[model samples]
Target: MSDERSYPTGIGTSTTDRIQLLGLDLADEVLGKVSFGELAYWLATKRRPTPGQLRVFEAALVSLADHGYTPTAIAARMTYYSAPESIQGAIASGLLGGGSRFLGVTEDTGQFLAASIAALGDTSGYSEDDWDAVARDVLEKAKSEGRKVPGLGHPVHKQGDPRTPVMFQIAREAEVFGPHLSLFEAIGRVHPEVLGRTLPLNGAGVAGASLADAGLPLGLLRGFALLARTAGLIGHLAEEQQHPVGPAIYAEVDRNATYVPPAP
Candidate 1:
């Protein structure tokens, strides 16, 4: 019965010499015909992307590829320094930090936007104020309950995330700009009126909106984030080889730590 509990997925399969993905032969049918971004979409969704969807997916992947000196990159570098033999360990450690608002905000924002849209189902005649009110109410309620609204603010780029505008443009060009994107934009506009501050669109917010608009599954957003950053993590690890910054980062953090002496 243990073997009877096998799980099934349409993702991919491998044999001795052949690999297949989404029913297409990997080497013969897919290798040169598709970009990695398009292949990525296929692996996740079991379908090919429209040119527009490919653009947005590519943008999201590139946008999150590497934020210089991010915690994830730092962790990857440090892990590489400590365990030079285990590059995979470094990558894994970096990805492990990507929950909540860290690097996983793209997933959080997508899920949040999906839920918000679902809650406002059948908006046949919702006026601008009505939709805005609904959004503000939702935001306020989440705030009152001390919930972290994913993908709104950023630590740096106070004016706006440079990536956000580009992602929005890509979505617009792709014609995938839908309610989720609108909801995030609306939230941005109504933020000052409702929350007494402006929280402009960040990259994660754009990622969420774009993926949702592009019709990707909400549950897969986190996986997408990890995949996107894996490219960046690989870059960081490679850089750590020639120009090692991991030790310096570690030493700087160590210097900043205020040790509390244990009771004698």
Candidate 2:
């Protein structure tokens, strides 16, 4: 007598008659009343955020909204070149690159920080030494197991990610910085000691840690990264339309290919 597949969620529900988002009418109550960032947070966390929390969330979104010519952006632009008719497909192409190696660093960093923090015995009022020990132990364990530390080092920014400082500054102002950010700092400080090299804190790592500090769910961190990069990819694709570098991107790769002749 009852439909077996029916389901319900606190997030939102829709039907032919009307649509609702988190119990608010979509057309009359939610639209323009709440920001996209606030709506996204509520959809995921199932609660409206305070003004401070919203500020921190907005800061994270803005900090990650764009980065010029990243691999994701490049893929998006190239996909656009291949299928100029489908801009959405090109955006999807760019988002597909947000796995462990690229844009997914935010998620990875959050897990890494959380795991390391749990490994730390106690932190009722952690001292510098306590933070340093946990950070060093994390690096040492990773080294012994030949595992890569997720949130350290940047290829282009040798000293540090320029965006990292700004993100932290905002987090500090918003009072959202927490143990995750502290742990990240400790790891960077001890990189030379444990890894025998200075690996700057990259943007992905900071974004992850900062979001974690903001009390966001670790599992959804990747989604944030993807969202931010999607905005960036759109910008790249728009320029790609005018300057049209996608073909040249392919050409450059072709020019640099190494040929291996058959053994005689």
Candidate 3:
């Protein structure tokens, strides 16, 4: 064997004379030419998206960016309050809070939709009624298994999630609407019959379907949500620097705590 080591990556690389990303000149072809949203999709899929795909992808990103003082945002602000000097820590604290109850739903919904679609085998020429039937079966199986449907409801949006329809519209206009989205919409239509009363297809779930339809990898759906939320967290930190509510939040919770003795 020769005394040499090789590292291979399709993402990015740099040397003395040139920097390359996704087989393009990062300085000449990418910078000032590609939007950050487009660049993110290109970097992830190793394939440049069409204008429609980019629109749908970025819409998904924007939908998941922030939702006003969610636990992740609070965690970020509180971490910033506790460690004012470590901005990265504050951002990390926010991202770390993206779990099952929060940002993780993006991936969960995408995976659920994808799995349901895959189970249909040959899905060619599947009509709306066919998709609704598929959606019914999917919900019925999930109900039987006692699994909470990830993107079916929201805490605040009892009437409807405004973002859900907007995402569907964007996907429709972009012409990137695909099976995942079709199935999700079917779920919205037919879920009342399966699970009783209606639940709006929340934004997070719609974002997942939108991302999946945009041809992004199912596994990286949550990562995309986190990428968007990173921007939101930075905004929160900037506000924390200016108006500074982290301490107030901390104080409110701290003052409300009551001590309760454990049984001996």
Pick the lDDT winner: 3
What's the true lDDT of residue 108 in model 3? 95
All-Cα superposition RMSD per candidate = 2.6, 2.2, 1.2
> What are the Cα lDDT values of the candidates?
0.84, 0.85, 0.92
In terms of lDDT, the poorest run of 10 residues in model 3 is 115-124
**By the TM-score metric, which is better: model 2 or model 3?**
3
lDDT of 1: 0.84
| Worst 10-residue lDDT window, candidate 1 | 1-10
lDDT of 3 at 259: 90
TM-score of decoy 1:
0.90
lDDT score, candidate 2, position 205: 89
Clash total of candidate 1: 0
Candidate 1 structure quality by residue, lDDT tens digits, 53-170: 8888888888888888888888888999999999999999999988886768888898888888886777656666776776797789888998867888899988889988888788
Better of 2 and 3 by lDDT: 3
True-vs-predicted CA distance for residue 182, candidate 1, Å: 0.7
Best by TM-score: 3
